[model samples]
Target: MDWGLVLVLLLMGAFGGFSAGLLGIGGGMILVPFITMIFSARGFAPEVIVHMAIATSLGTILFTSMSSVRAHHLHGAVRWRIVALLSPGILLGSWIGPWIGKQMSSTVLALFFGLFISFSATQMLLGKKPSGGRELPGTVGMFAAGGLIGLLAGLVGAGGGFISIPFMGWCNVKIHNAVATSAALGFPIALAGTLSNIFYGWGVADLPPYSLGFIYLPALAVIATASVLFAPLGARTAHRLPVATLKKVFAVVLYCLAAYMLWKAFH
Candidate 1:
């Protein structure tokens, strides 16, 4: 429990949580690479560091999403019907993702995370929407969409808002509803993803101290606490401001992260 490390984690948590509330992402997309850096610096097993990063990112998402969703719920923005429809498939897909992911190397996972998040960021920046005549999918369609979202989210340690929001928007859901619903979906994604990480990484060698499989308990504690505290504030800010421009700024940040990960992979 180094004080310096605790401070860094707290700062990371605050940023990630605030971003999650504000942009429907910012949790895992932001946390994964930074957490990877920390774990690598600490000299954990190279094969397992990205796994730990993704798992810990998901762990932080658990609290941050709860906090963000509570704020959205207070504003009557969350579509519980949609959440209910999506959760089952999301959970199933999330559960399967880590098992698949555990076979890949840290470098490969990092590269994937970098590319995927960058694509998500590009889509956010574009801010495209389909025509208004379309509507959200029916039960089966929603489940399939949820499954895909959850699997990608689990593999990359994202909250899935980046993809889900766009998907909903394409289906002619209102931006607010889509964002709110995406926040709701983060819960299942994080929970199932964390469970998968635990199971998939169980009994692997050279896990850091205090790790339950890939989920680092100490990092989870510090990051989750700070992220939760800041999430509501971000939600409030979202209510106050127009987010289109902000997303462009965030997109640039995500691209930088992608570039860094690519650098790390090849260097």
Candidate 2:
């Protein structure tokens, strides 16, 4: 094991988990690119590197989301009603996401992931609000919305907050509540996605050791360990941080990552 690399992964996890707590995202946006670079440098097959990154990102979220949600719940920010309405469809969509990924060419998947992440970052940077404060939709509509979130999240290994938060905000949900509720929804999205990735990657060729299907357990273990510990800290800091500044900084970083991935895909 590369202890140096392990330390770096720990650092990334800490930051990622903190962001999850602060921003109500699952931290996969931070994890995927770095994980891919690490796997690539370690000589993993190019075809499977992105899969490993995505799978391990989701697996790590299984733990990080729990820690984040607990902190948000204690603050009474989580909307249990929203969670209930979105969960069933989230479960179904998440379960199918990795299956779709595996069927696509790795390069194509990377391209799509890059474009999607860039779009998400652009949304944050623009920080647009809906002109009308419409109420949330009916059960079927919420279910459909949940399905879309889950599918996109599964495809890109995110917590779905990039979509969910914006969606809730458009519906006039308070920002804090939207963040907390998105954190709650992240678990089912990740859990179902992770399980599906594991099953989907079984018996695949060129997979690295210590892997469970598409997931690399060592990365998950190291990242989750640090993320779970620091998440509460991020949650607490969310109350004090200059969020607009932080979001801008984070958006810059995401844009860079997106550009890098897109360059890699086309080059």
Candidate 3:
């Protein structure tokens, strides 16, 4: 184990966990970009770095989401009924997402991830809440929505909060409930995405040692451990902090990451 790299992953995990807890984002947005930079710095193969970053990020979210959602559940904020309704579709879509991603070149994958991250940042910066005059759709409709959310999140290595929160709010779910429910939904998205990515990345050439499919095992383990420890603290802070202001600051950081990915994609 490289102690230096372990330290870096620890710090990233701490921050990512806090952000996951506070923002209901499951930390993938932050993890994916940084993991890309780290792997690139380490001279991982260009063909595999982006895929590994995405896969590892999703794997870490498996732990982060569990920690964050447990906190949210304690607050009685999670809408389990909705989670049940959406998960089947989320699973199906998430499974397909990585398969599609595997077919894209690194440049194209990075470009796509960058674009979506920028869009998510813009939404955060604008602080635009979807109008709330409707109720959640029927099971079939929810399944379709879940599929779309899961697919996009898998592609970008997000927690599905970017799409799910807005959709929930649009359907008149309260903001707190939306955030909590999104956190709960992250598990299924991550589970399916991570597994699918692993399957697709199996037997790929030039993979790093200790890599399980596209996931760097060391990074995933370290990050998930660190992220889990901090997630509850972040969840506690979320109710106390001026989250709107924080979101703007986080959005700015995301813009910088997006710019980096764009540069990576092109050169």
Candidate 4:
């Protein structure tokens, strides 16, 4: 094993896990860009690097999301009713997303990821609130909303918080509840997205060793181990911290990452 690479992944996991707990974002927004950088630097085929990064990021979320959500659940923050309502659609959309991604050229996919992250960052920076009196939609409406959230998240390897939190907030759900529910929802998004990526990427040419479809298993292992440990700490901190400040700082970081991805796409 490359010890240097392990160190990098460990650090990434620690930070990503903390973010997952704090933001209910599953850390994929952070992981995808960094993983892409690492893979690109290591001379992995450009065509596969972004996909592998995306898939592996989701794979790590499989562990981190659980740890994060458990801590949030302990805090009585999760809205389980919303999770149940949204899951069926999330599953279907998540699976379809990676399949669609598999058909796109790497450059186009990278462009999409970059643009979407930029949009998410803008949403964060603005910190918009919904008008009062709006309520969450009924089952059919929620399912459709969930599908949209899942699709966008899978395409970009996110946990869907960027969309779901805002949607819930617009419907007058409490912020903490929205965050916790988004964390609970991450598991299903990651599960379907990971499986779909694996299926679509199976037997692709020029893939690096130790790949399970598009996922780099070694990175997944290292990231997941470190991320799970840090996630609870982040969840606890989320209850105390001024989340607005954190979101603004994180937004800046995301903008930078988006810029990097855009540069990579062009090159």
Which portions of model 4 show Cα errors greater than 4 Å?
none
lDDT (10s digit) by residue, model 2, range 1-267: 789999999998998899999888789998898888888889899899888899999998899989999998998999999999999889998988999999977798889989998998998888787768599999999999999999989988999999999999999998888988999999999999999999999999999898899999988999999999988887777667776677788888899888877875765
What tens digits encode model 3's per-residue C-alpha lDDT throughout 1-267?
A: 699999999999999999988888889999999999999999999999999999999999899999999998999999999999999999999998888899999999999999999999999899877765789999999999999999988888889998998889889898778888988999999999999988999999999999999899999999999999998888878878888899999999999999999999998
Q: Estimate, for each residue in 1-267, the C-alpha lDDT of model 4 and write its tens digit.
A: 599999999999999999989988889999999999999989999889888999999899889989999999999999999999999999999999898888887899899999999999999899898899998899999899989988988888889999999999999998888988999999999999999999999999999999999999999999999999998988889899998889999999999999998998999
The all-Cα superposition gives candidate 4 an RMSD in Å to the true structure of: 0.7
Model 3: number of backbone collisions: 0
Query: Least accurate stretch of 10 residues (summed lDDT) in model 1?
Result: 258-267
Clashes of 1: 0
Cα-based TM-score, every candidate = 0.98, 0.98, 0.98, 0.99
| lDDT per residue as tens, model 1, 1-267 | 799999999999999999899877737888888888898788888888888989999988989999999998898988899899889889998888887789888888878888887788789788886777888789999899999989988888889897888888888887787787888899999999999999888898989889998899999999999999998887777878888888898888888888877766664
Return the lDDT, model 4, position 60.
91
Runs in model 2 lying further than 4 Å from the true structure: none
The parts of candidate 3 lying over 4 Å away from their true place are none
Clashing pairs in 2: none
Q: lDDT score, residue 111, model 4?
A: 95
RMSD of 3: 0.9
User: When superposed on Cα atoms, how far off is each prediction in RMSD?
Assistant: 1.0, 1.0, 0.9, 0.7
